[model samples]
Target: MLTRTRMLAVLLSGLCWTQGAWAQGSPTGPAVVATIKPLQFIAQAILDGEGSVSALIEGSDSPHHFNLSPNDRLRIEQADVLLWIDPKFEVYLAALFADTAASESSLMVTASAISGLTLHRYPDGELDPHLWLSQGNALLIAQALTEQLACIYPDKAPHFRAGLDQFRSGIDKQAQALQRRFSNQHVADYLVYHDAYRYFEHDYGLTHSASLVADPDIQPGMREVLELRETISASSPACILLEPDASPALVNTMVQNDAVKRITIDLLGNSLESSANAYRQLIDHVATGFLSCLNI
Candidate 1:
């Protein structure tokens, strides 16, 4: 059974595709607009030399807290095919999609709208939207975006599909490389400041013992903190993970203990545009972070 959030996502995605089915625009050239940087990168890579693709959020900033700059608004208005993740994570995107539903030059693809988009929650019921952290899920996302682009711009369908095939193949090779690289190291269990990266950990058979269910927002009382301390003491995990902006308390715990390794992993490309500009590099960074902790 789908949860209410998922059900709403399904309804919104239906509306997204239904608008296209009913009204196919006759634009000559393709100018795709993506909501996030990673989505933009994948679309551009697929339409390499075939179309014009760009992103509204090109900064190494959190899309969850993204404010539309003047350039962002301009790009959104000019985009022909807009690809984005679930708007539940981005309020501006949700409102923008609602307003542009009647427009002919706009299309939005949400990651939560597709199959194989795994939804996870903490034991307390908070959602994790960081699906792009895992290489496997990233491949699925890339495939969906490529297919949608091909469908919308059939004039370049052949070119798009060929590029997609190559990209997917390359991604597969990278996945294999990740697996082989970490197979013997066996850094299965690591502590995270936030409850993200299940997809990446699951793909690599690693265990994510997250310190917080929700990042930056996690409010653990004294009891929870004490319990977490015990868990860390027992596990003695090879590394403790922290994000630059997440949980100061949890990170301080590790620093105080001096019992585990410390690794800073960034979900938003290290809060920089270059390191996390693509899916493959993001996955690589995660895998490398894990292996680096194991002293592998």
Candidate 2:
């Protein structure tokens, strides 16, 4: 049986042939848009200098509450290729794609729909849309993007393939280094502000003792907070991983022990500039944040 990656490569090759030749090499190439920063980072790496890539949601904006303005809608409509995680992750874009002709476009690539992704689920069994947190998933996403871009710009196919090779090499090297670093240390108990890092934690052999809330958009109620406090008291977690914008006051209220370190991990890469290396940097930042709070 063919691997999913091999199957996807075959499908993409057929797409390139059926779509026919595209006019290549305009001033800036195609306008590629990603719904969020992390997706944008992957596209940036694959596009390299071959094209432009931008995110619809930037800075500290949470996709859960992001509102699409008229300008944002126009950008999506005008984009040659649009990449996003899933409809469930970016609920704002779900309706637009559902109602508009954009859904029919061959250029629209939803990462969730991509083959061979190791998707996770919440305890209640809802699809976990944070698939990009895994380096393996990121490589698969890059492969899909590279094939799609190559189809659009046959002239730039070599550059896009080269970009994909470079991205895979960088990610593999970084993952190996992280695995080595983590192998030497004993697993430390930790708590998370929310259950956003399941993919990351699973990838690096780390696990959180408890999560204050399942949804980042929802704050923990009194009952949930009390329970979390009890768990903290019982486990004495080495660290409590907080989101970049998470309130330290809440953690302070739950944790009175000074030895319990608080570390802010930005899964969205909000502070980093857009570059080919941005995805790798994001992974490194997350790993360093975890290592810092460890007892070692």
Candidate 3:
């Protein structure tokens, strides 16, 4: 038979022991998920050691054509923070965004949340969502992401800020170097398979005189193709730019003995492994592609 004081002491001892074990358990950072590779690269740079960063969409699949898998849905649902471009950029994510925006997990960050962005509008009044191509926009994105991450992990705010600063410094130098590289080349006429690089052209002061298709998912009409052919015949653009995985047959047919240069530029960074410098590598690759074609 235990005395009252003994029973109280035993209860207190067990409580303390349980708490000690609980405290011994390691703490984990949040699970962060970005919708695309570029976003993942930015997040990985900022989160580095704080938490793991992952992208839901990968490979050569354009974000415009990506169909979310069950695993992707699960990843989004489980994420402590979910980041993506505007719903207009990723139309497939519109429904999931609606649900999440309505629920408690409104952690989705968009370009609108970032400052100092130059938004592009089409003749039909649709906003271009490829703002990530601009290095300035990348800085704004890092700032917005760092702020959100700090809110989620207040204790780690300094860490996130430091990462962001490093990213800004690195990207700034890369952008400047790219500008210098392009500055020496005489402005040249170019053609593209899609209208996705307007932001890049705008940022770098280059011109894409013609585009075969307005949308990547939709096949260009014969009229549009013929118009592009005529434009190329008339202008004799220095280069025809295609996406990384674009069909060589179609590309060859478009240029068709015109003796024009053909180069592939990857907007999605699909060929490079995702890392802190992946964004820079993507920009560098684009610069190299442009220089190769334009110099010819």
Candidate 4:
């Protein structure tokens, strides 16, 4: 027969061993990293607490000119899954992903290449990578994310599927609400600082009369400015949609008429906190901005 102290020690050892085994067997999901906040928002919805999601480009930084730092590189290297729009838009990430060594260990998702998404092109024939603006495209993205994540962590496939369903339902509800809101009001013609809202506008049946510039980095010249001003004066558009970072002076130059309203549309979700519903909030906020200006 064992002594009381010996029996107690043996029981404690067995308990510790069992705990260790359980810990080792527990399923811990992947660490996903997105190239931008909008992508991160979509990923967060699908991940839905099954894993971690983070954005590489935060705040007002434009991916067009974003350069990765040592920390950023480390984050990408350590991530189990990486998400980005495409090489054309996120030009900085193209070369990094091209390296076989860099891409070998992780799942890299080029959202633009995902099938079932309705993609668009710029007037210059370049692919428009802002597909997330459309709730439909967002659904497709969520589905793709679910499938990719499921492949990596099959044990959490059910949770990911549930997340995708929830995301689709949330988008459908929000889109219906927005459609009702727009149907009850008159949305007048508008102009945008750049042609970035094509997906949003197409989804809502709203069209801009003109744009100040094709690319935000390239400011309109004197002739282009005069033409835009003439167009604004002639058509009397209800509003001029300026981005959060648009130049006030340029806007003033383009819109000398005080009757033309100016509304700041943040497509980047700059002011939003990171959450599962952030993508929906972004769409709602954008619609609200348009309604505030276009309703006259």
Top lDDT: which candidate number?
2
lDDT of each: 0.65, 0.80, 0.72, 0.78
Model 1 residue 183 lDDT?
78
Query: Candidate 3's residue-wise lDDT over 1-296, tens digit each?
Result: 32324323432332221222122222577567888887888788888677778887787677777888888888777665667887777888878865653353435566544546777876788887777788787777777777766666667879989999899999988888887877756778888877888788888888788777676667767777677777778887777888866767666656665677778888878778877788888788878888788882
Clashes of each: 1, 0, 0, 0
Q: Which regions of candidate 3 deviate over 4 angstroms?
A: 1-26
Off by over 4 Å in 4: 1-28, 100-103
lDDT of 4 at 123: 69
lDDT (Cα, tens digit) per residue for candidate 1, span 68-133 = 777777777766666777776666778776555446346556776667767666676755677676
Clashing pairs in 4: none
Q: Write the per-residue lDDT of candidate 4 for residues 99-205, one digit (tens) a residue.
A: 52233455567788776789989867888888889999999878877776766666787988998999999999999988877765566878899898889888877
lDDT of 1 at 75: 72
Worst 10 residues of 3 by lDDT: 16-25
Pairs in steric clash, model 2: none
- Index of the highest-TM-score prediction: 2
TM, every model:
0.80, 0.90, 0.86, 0.88
TM-score of 3: 0.86
Task: Say which prediction, candidate 1 or candidate 3, comes out ahead on lDDT.
Answer: 3
Give me candidate 4's TM-score against the actual structure: 0.88
